[model samples]
Target: MVGLQSTEHAGDNCTPLSDERGSYTTAENGFKEKDATDTHEYDVYGDEDTAEIKYRTMVWWKAAALMLAETVSLGILSIPSAFSSLGMVAGCILVIGLGALATATGYVIGSFKLRYPHVHNMADAGEILAGPIGREVLGAAQVIFIVFLCGSHVLTGLIAFDTITEGASCSVVWAVVTAVVCFICTIPRTLNGISYMSVVSFISILAAIFITMITVGVNGHTGTVTASAHLTFAKGFLAVTDIIFAYAGHVAFFTFIAEMKKPEDFPKTLYTLQICDTTLYLIVGIVVYAFVGDTAVAPALGNTGQLVRKIAYGIALPTIIIAGVVNGHVCAKLVFVRIFRRNGMKSKHMNSHTFTGWATWIAICLAIWALAFVIAEVIPFFNDLLGVISAVFASWFTYGISGIFWLHLTPRSERWTTTKQKAKTIFWSLVVMMGALIMVAGLYASIVSIIDGYKSGGFPGPFSCVSRAL
Candidate 1:
């Protein structure tokens, strides 16, 4: 059996507990102790054995690749559909711009917290800046939002499955298959394998985009560049909200930063990821809009595969299907980890058992899919409502949190210290307040859309119109 030792060198401030004594010992008996200059050793796993905890830094490119994989998934497929429903020209510009601004703001806030590296995660940073209440609020909000986002991904996967396997099998069966595949791909013991999977997903998605562009180019199609008579500013902004909702994974990027070896590298990685994501979204949006046109884009490709298959038959469909599965897996694992930790379960330990852990994950995935299926069948306009809610939260998380962090972190004396800093503070604060007001308006608009959908006898046309108007 091997033993481990911890040496307390100069400047070490940790206090020794009563259980830590003068000699090396097995943990099953009690924790060992060490003096200022002596090394203390312990048995690994309460046995007379020792093991090393290995740590490695992530390369900049790996971080960028992970972020790229996450950004491209369902967001790319949803953007063009949103543009068609909301009005292409207006939706594309506003949504893409606002989403980028919000994301960049979040990166700034994260960078500010990283200046004091002792804080481990966003929740810890919130606590340092604002106290216990801030920690609880931020932690609870993050966990809940992650869960909802995971549920949203499950719903998206089911929708994709239904689209691909239309008329051949039941939607529920397809949903189960997709969920199981996602669970297997996720819930692993380590994050090392995800990089390769992410690369594959990225490649597959790019191929689909290539097919889409070729199809549009060969057809000599150039999409409508202006809004129609029916399109108004109100509809334009609402459509913008929808497009932002599809790209609202900015906050989630912080989770990766927390685990990164060099937290300071996050800003560069985040900026690069967002730039890549925006470029991809713009190119895909142009191609999809050109190929299908506004009149056909809205209702024709209800699923991602339908759109891909329409452009290219052999490879595009399967490529998109695999990409959807990868996205669903990543989202599920993220949500599960957050929820489990919030409930006081050690996710690392729980996730080690493949059978039990995966079974629990599968159950959660099914429940989310079931709820989505019911909403899709009964409400039909549920997607629009989801889009609005997601946008509201995304806006609050980006603008509100960024403003709060900046306000709280700056010293009171520095409030009026510099003209540029003062201007920045005011600008951020106003952005936060405006985001809050917009969220309120979005909620009201969502309610109105739902009512209109009910009155229209299950038709989502009125909701789409209202969504565009907002």
Candidate 2:
């Protein structure tokens, strides 16, 4: 907290750095405040000696754990299905290739955060690029993206329960139960606290997937394995977007860096995350696809025997709920910070436990969970939802926006000054174009898939009592 500053602004609008937004400098020990902004104190809990709540307590590993938990959860649930559609060769290629790109984009986000220490979230980053409009637009998009993500977790929870229970109870009831639990878990105000829970989340997912892989391998089901397949545009693209969604954790990278004890260590956190997720995705996608082939389903746990599937889903429960809790916490914190920023009490409420602050935080969490529940019930299809999210939001948050950030950070003259600079400029430009293409094509694929789902009665209608268990 010594060198850290609050990401909160003095007013509702995203303030410019010279006025309210200041910068950071690296010290021998770690990040030391160079020109601290009086507009907002970086420390949420004032007076470290007696403060009640603290936000900037995460070390690099803890942040890495949070990113791993957030990124690896439900996203991995669909990769085998992607492999089934795109084949083993293409699946492995996309997993590794997209992961490297995600790592690069995540690095850009860290550099952007270091450049503007006050920029805590996408909204703040947006302000740096385009003032109030960017802040509003990007901020809203971030919230929506996280909420939908949170809802996806809720949806996964419902699937787990139905799979475990063998559809003995209503899926709606399971959704309600999932939402309540996630809302309760999101009550704590600090990422540092959630970081510990993320450890359990990561372990839970590892165990579940390993169990799934072992069980499927033991069964030795024979199905066709193809290097590639012919498919329609919508089908092929949807599979691609599902893989894209697996790397969509970049949306929360800003918040992760903001909470880190040493913001400069973010590259370590980024690499840690990319390494863990990509390796897991490759192993899980390939092994599962090799065994189950065309018969594989999303949330690959469903590929095993009913008994083992139940066990895997039960084990996966923690990740399904906790990962969503992390997303809900980020979304709620955004609103909580905005509320305090508006009243000029951002520090007081954030620093210590106040009745008003606590109430607002709970209310925000409640609202977010409720909305997430509705979204879960409405969308109802797993692969389609992931496709839509990756296409619309992840395309920018994970890829496009970072390209913009790199372009904005580098001076035009400097971009062509050296061979390395020229190569980077060209690479980043291609990254931006790739993001745009994904967004446009992904939306189309998702829309078409959704319509096809309804037409084929592939899943029950929104809010239907039918079980969606894998």
Candidate 3:
């Protein structure tokens, strides 16, 4: 395989590569190269000559498919509800604007990774910007972000089971069953292993939502479909946050790029994710909201007739579970890498598929899934959980951090030297501010909504056996 080479243009804009630890550099390609004696440590495929497992093997399309599966997961379920709150004009604008912003930020992430080829996750990128403390802070944040996503999936699974079964079983029992199934599905150790499953995930969600759109369109709507709504501040912002969550997949881009066969092909992968998701979000959100109008519920699957609702949720089962599996793999890999790297045995054990490697990976997956189950039982409400996760984590990881990355990549001296460069500088500056505004305002809205839900008995208490089925 040809190594990833930075285009002359990409190289010109980037600062000369240097490493504090002197263990890696960008001279070999777009990736880092270890010393001669430690050559295998940073080999793109992790000592492929002897190792039983290889990670950097996915082609661009496969990586794009995995990202589509990971990103376009449960988030899509919330878009139509957002439309109901924000109305058609504001909802469509936010969806398109945010999707475009997510694409730009995602591109920034790809550039940052190419410049510092060793950076595999947010934590690594953090290290370059702020040192060990940055590493710890961003690393913890990334894990928390992915974990919340896992929890969201678990919550969706619970809802799916309840919706499908008509509440025949205790909700808690369904939550446990959901977690166990996610645990088993996440046992695959490599992105390459899981990429095939993502195809099924993508197809499953497409079929489920299309069925819903067709059914709802034919049956007609519950209330007026407006271009605008006169909602309160908290209500409106909460709706906007749901749209933000729909494009929150930027958090996983670095990890995806790391595992790609040709990291330089990431532009194709990024565009693939953005286009598919944006088009899908617009169609699904508009169609569902137009049909259900003001009475639309989240996860949107429940808005259909009883039989169709069950069928939609049933068809959506693979995406609900497999998408979670994709994220579960990320968190598990983060922990797995941190452990082995700390002990100076990463390449040997992680790449060789040793007993220690397999044991540690499985244990980590089990532990993370168990935590996800707890979070699902505690939160129990789908929209509120997504709102909080979007506010707290997605705000920074997806938007704010990427802006910082772009600013960091350009040489300060050159930032104002050209018209195009100046425009980029100004745009990225706004992106940073937008992320902060979303975080602060979004947190307030999400909190208020949750409080209101509890006060009005709209939300069941944590771990209550109440069914969240619509």
Candidate 4:
């Protein structure tokens, strides 16, 4: 210990963690630890009030269900279309490959949360990664990504409305209806209340997909099947971005982990998301594309014949609405806690008779959902828009940030001290590079696709009322 200058672990705020007592000075970085029995000190919230019990009350299974709903809803619906675009073989490969990588990154996020328990959102982690600037950058990126995700759900609900009612109303009206309903659902003040609907949301999507697979399989008519071994880079990349979207739940992993009754069960949550999404995605994509072929559409429900599509949409209604609610809840919670509970983990005013607190929460719900509505309507194309959003957000939040968190936490000396350590370092370094590649390459593909949409007269003017199907 001669030159080490040993010190206990310190958080970003240099907030003294209770339970572990005596501390004369703070550790400059978060990478070290101190004994639990040292001395007596208290954080701003104190030992008894670290996190309100209400915030961390969720069981692991419920947490998994919530994550599954948030991630698996609209994403799986697009996979058959990705398969159609990239060729069957390549699409399946991407599903498994990207899914595995996303799961790995998700695990990294959980580990980072365990390392720094004070991190309730990407913004907190961002502060740790750099300083004040990192918090602002990463925090904005996180909320924006979640807003886009919520918007995607609202867009899907509009599409579903069209599918079921055969365009009974203008697209804008349908979007408004979806946003209002989702905002209402988002009024719940806690993740525990939201998790109840998430269970239904997950079941709804699963059932809807099962019906679609069966409908396509039983029809026994290959609807213009075309298989290709080759694809242009743009076509292939678009397909890959859809896969990225399917596994792009990293924007939400921190909140889910933070709310868990046992943080150690996070791997179980990751396993739940990947196992279910990957298996369902491959089966649904390959089976549906094998039957529906090149004409297969994003949000696979469209690939079914008219009546069957209507039925599937009806069943999927819950997921379309509830998944967006879950995303909106997380986004709003990030802002809500920051404003009301800035000094502590949970606000005593959250569910109390506090009128201002309730009013603020309601306003946040309306504002976020309304913004999501605008995003959903402004970018009308489903798969193309998702590719754009995924490329812009997921590549960094889900992949790159997780890699950064891992590299930040692991001790520098441990990596170079042994051969195994060196190999591990190389592996994580490549992981970081892979995230950068996805961010750069995927962004290029998305921009190209959006331009193509404009050139081909496929672009609807922002806030235009024209049917998206046109």
On TM-score, the leading prediction is: 2
Residues 1-470 of candidate 1: C-alpha lDDT, one tens digit per residue: 01112233222222211122233322221112224333332211111112121112455566676667666665666666666755566556766776677665766666554433333344545665667776667656654554455445544545455554443555545445544555555543333455566676677667766765565566664445435326444554555565666556655555555445566777777777778787877777766665655643532233234456534322333433444433444445445544434211133323344465557677655554444334433445656567565656766665666666666555555555568767766776787786787677666666666676678786533112111100
Measured by lDDT, the strongest candidate is: 2
**Candidate 3 similarity to native, TM-score:** 0.90
Write down the lDDT that model 1 would get: 0.52
Native-vs-model 3 lDDT? 0.82
Model 2, span 143-258: residue lDDT tens:
98998888888888988999999888999999999999999999999999999999999999999999999988998966889999899998998899988999999999988887
Report the C-alpha lDDT of model 4 over 273-358, residue by residue, as the tens digit.
88988898898888999888887887788877789888999999999999999899999988876664343333445434467778
Q: Which stretches of candidate 2 lie over 4 Å from their true place?
A: 1-50, 342-345, 380-386
Evaluate residue 280 in candidate 4 and report its C-alpha lDDT on the 0 to 100 scale.
85
Ten-residue segment with the worst summed lDDT in candidate 1? 42-51
lDDT of each: 0.52, 0.84, 0.82, 0.77
Model 1 per-residue lDDT at 327: 41
Report the alpha-carbon TM-score of model 4 versus the true structure: 0.88
- In model 1, residue pairs whose N, Cα or C atoms come closer than 3 Å (at least 3 residues apart or on different chains), thus clashing, are 234-469, 235-468, 235-469, 238-470
For each candidate, give its TM-score against the true structure: 0.71, 0.91, 0.90, 0.88
Across 208-310, the per-residue lDDT of candidate 3 in tens digits comes to 9999999999998776799999999999999988888888888888888878889899999999999999999999889999989988888888789999999
